[model samples]
Target: MSDTCSNVQGYVDPNWPRPDDDGSSCIIIYGYVPSFALGVLGVVLFTTALVAHSYLLSRYRTWYFSTVIVGTVMEIIGYIFRILASKKNPYSVAYFVGQYFCIVVAPVFYSAAIYTLITPMTKRIGREYAPLSPKVILWTFIICDIIATTIQMTGAGLIGRAYSDGKDPTTPNNILLAGLAFQVFSFAVFIFCLLFFLVRSRNTTDRHFKIFSTAVLVATLAVYLRTCIRLAETAEGLLEFLSTHEAIFGCLEFLPIVIAVYIFVYWHPGRWLGSESIHKKTGKSELEVSQLPR
Candidate 1:
């Protein structure tokens, strides 16, 4: 027993005792109690957002809300794993892997939801103001999101595998950095497109459109901020300051996403575009509305 324990002294395994236990020491400085508390808070908040999304879906029937719901669910699960890692065994590979993969990929779904909104919004406001057709814009950004998701997931898997195997993680870390960089670039482009649309359609007077557009802009900025943080965190590598620091993660990662989640909930697109669907109705009348112009 002593031999086995000594052999794995620098590594964490499922059979190892927690550091809080007598004669046991953690392989890494686990996340702090406050970090665990924050993870729990994230789970609760996301669950509430999920509930709100369901209610919105029932009334509005827009499939786009599903993306938000999925993203929230992933975030809740990711935080749950983060809480698990915060236990006396912070080096628990499974817990870290689960938390990292889920949390990082969760925002892609939010980006998708934002992209979905663009189609409906463009149609209602004026397609002429958009650089591309609604369908083209929707699919184009969704495809970019998919590409980013794939790269990040692949990189995460490689990093996790390398860590577990007690091998150097530099290659995988670089891959992860590349993936984060791509996501940051993609989000920047998406934000630019959104701003362009807003500027081009500034003449829109519909109250619902204004509210929906404002919500989208806020959500996009929040998500963009979070993405930039992630890019920096990844660039610093897994064991670096940003990666090890719970405070940075809580403030930059957890807070921004939660803000975006609430923004989407408060200004739910369904309220404007759902059953009794004002966006569709307004879109149909756009030709007539355009004749008057602003």
Candidate 2:
């Protein structure tokens, strides 16, 4: 099935490492099983979110669900490509382009989840302490994300070209390094701004602060950890023996984001904001706000 497998009309290369040679092997590292499994997971999660959104139409707005759906779709697409690649080991150039680009870029939609939080936080914390308006933050980062994504994808394409050509790995390596560097810088700025807002709003009368703040803090920490691991992996490039060390990367990048997803689902920003708005508009006393809102 693999192009590499087809090309080898001659005897198999004994020099190549066999699965039997190493005690350590996994579907993620040695076969297509991992991609298929992950793809299924993505589909299930995406479908669940869609159903949840449909039922909540009256309770929350479209954009809240839209971002999650889009992010889930990106993840689904990425894993699909991975599954395809698994079926054919020496996958086409487009396979590399599609899979890695989607995998990296999907996180942008994750940031969209972060954006949904702001609308609610704005109401709870008050506009004065919101650090900046939701509109400003949303448009600013989304636009920048577009630009950043373009750079990263373009770089990934070039890297794929390099690999296809069998050129020195340096060309693609540099592009990957550049993209990761920019991503780290972008996330660092976002973290700084978000942390500043939460700190300033800590003492505010917003009832949802306790829940929202904790959720946000957890999400921020997950992003931070994901970025750090990405930085290290990209920096080492092909030189590192652990490039495909499945479990480590999985625990760091995939696991944290999964945790963040559950945290967000638990927090459910739209519900928090809606309840807060109802409380304030009804002119309920601070003590009474708690008793009736939930």
Candidate 3:
């Protein structure tokens, strides 16, 4: 799509002398007016998460969880841009790109934070049961995350350039799609490995390990769901149903992320695994009640 909003496929009439002259003339970059209410809600939830994470950081010094800090900050910035896009110019390319980059890539950081879990988890359960060394697993996923984040950033820059220069957005869109899709795939693999590690070690673990693992699982599912929603929206083309619908975004994307962040706070790593005095040794991290720690 072009900055003039003329070339945007499935959107823009391309005949209007002034595309953003009025809402009637063009559907706008977002396809619909972003809700100020939801934007505000995003700010509130992410801000609260940031504050909670800050406290946890200070108290526990679990620096490995720094990725969550990065994630929350991105969410806050993204939502701020969203609020601006809603209140000011929904058609402004700058605002759209700002929110796009921050919101879309924030989960990359979250995935990194989640990936760190395997190292300690493996150590707790006996690394011999894991198919690969815990450090190897951690680094592998984190590297994949870095690669995905780089791709998203690269695509974001190119898309902005494309819009500004009145060039075709197809290339950038493809890049973004590939990046997001790969991230989702990597996460699915990570989940599989996590499950495999747990199932193979079916003995039992302490309460702390269970709580810590549960937090990761819940947060992981929420983030995974959010990413899947995003991938679907992007894959369908910018002006399609998922992209145009604010309600879908609110329910699927926004709600899940908020739940993910808050869930982590409630079952925080710092609260559970922070002390590291868990009394048990081995087990899986899944639905089997017997495998769960008492």
Candidate 4:
């Protein structure tokens, strides 16, 4: 990480040659290219989801669509910085700033997606089956998610400042650790809530119900894995284990998120909305039929 130290020194003046013995080669920048590429792919997929949702405004929920839009935009911005970093070793301070900011905020929309799922889930599975009220799920997890996001952003800023000031930014690892731990805690609570409701509503059955339930479970599991991987990465700092294992990051972060995105795409609430109209005639709630959340 002395390379980062030297890079910071050279970055202040903006035109200095990169440190020759600092262990960072220009080629190292390209090492991040695949992540940037995957980020772009994420943007496209999320954008498609947004547009499809918006075009079928009557069929899709606004909160879900908006969250997708915002998450996509964040991924786009994150990739832009990644590309910049690819082009410039250590990258410009501004590029690093944007990358950290956007990536950190992206998970907030994920939390929003999680929140949006709760009320609809309660409606679908019957509120009585829900382990916690929609209000409780919303207020508690959303607040914790927000706190995690704030901690991450602040930690990223502190690390940046420390690096720029020629101090050991790794000392602020506790902030990042706290944020990740908070996120994991929130997600664990959510999983408990989901499982509680799901088990309670097991009698409600259908192919679609099964599919959506599996999708929700998969998404939750994916996020949990991503959270753990991030925690490991942060704990590792610039250690060789992290630096040499790019594929591990990809599998832990990208693959899980891809699974999540695809789950959302296929298990969208649109199909069920039509079926709900049928249930209206029977004077029964969709909750009685399917416990799946949107």
Q: Could you give the candidate ranking by lDDT, starting with the highest?
A: 3, 1, 4, 2
Listed in order, each prediction's TM-score against the native is: 0.85, 0.74, 0.85, 0.77
TM-score, candidate 4, is 0.77
Tens-digit lDDT string for candidate 4 (1-294): 345454432212234344444223322321233355665565576567556545543454334435655665676677667665555544344566567667656756765675667675566557898887898888888788888988988887786665445566676767977897788888888888888888888888556666777777887787778777777777767333653455875677657765765666666654543234534464334444455554
Clashing pairs in 1: none
Q: Summarize candidate 3's per-residue lDDT along 180-239 as a digit string, tens digits.
A: 999999999999898787677756776666666767888899999998998998899777
lDDT of 2 by residue, 17-74 (tens): 3233122111122212235566556556655654564444335453553565566567
Q: How well does candidate 3 score on lDDT at residue 241?
A: 92
Candidate 1 regions with alpha-carbon error over 4 angstroms: 1-26, 29-34, 276-294
Q: CA shift at 50, candidate 3, in angstroms?
A: 0.1
Superposition error at 290 for model 2 (Å): 9.3
Clashing residue pair totals per candidate (backbone < 3 A): 0, 0, 1, 1
Over 4 Å off, model 3: 1-27, 275-294
- Model 1: residue 144 alpha-carbon error in angstroms: 0.8
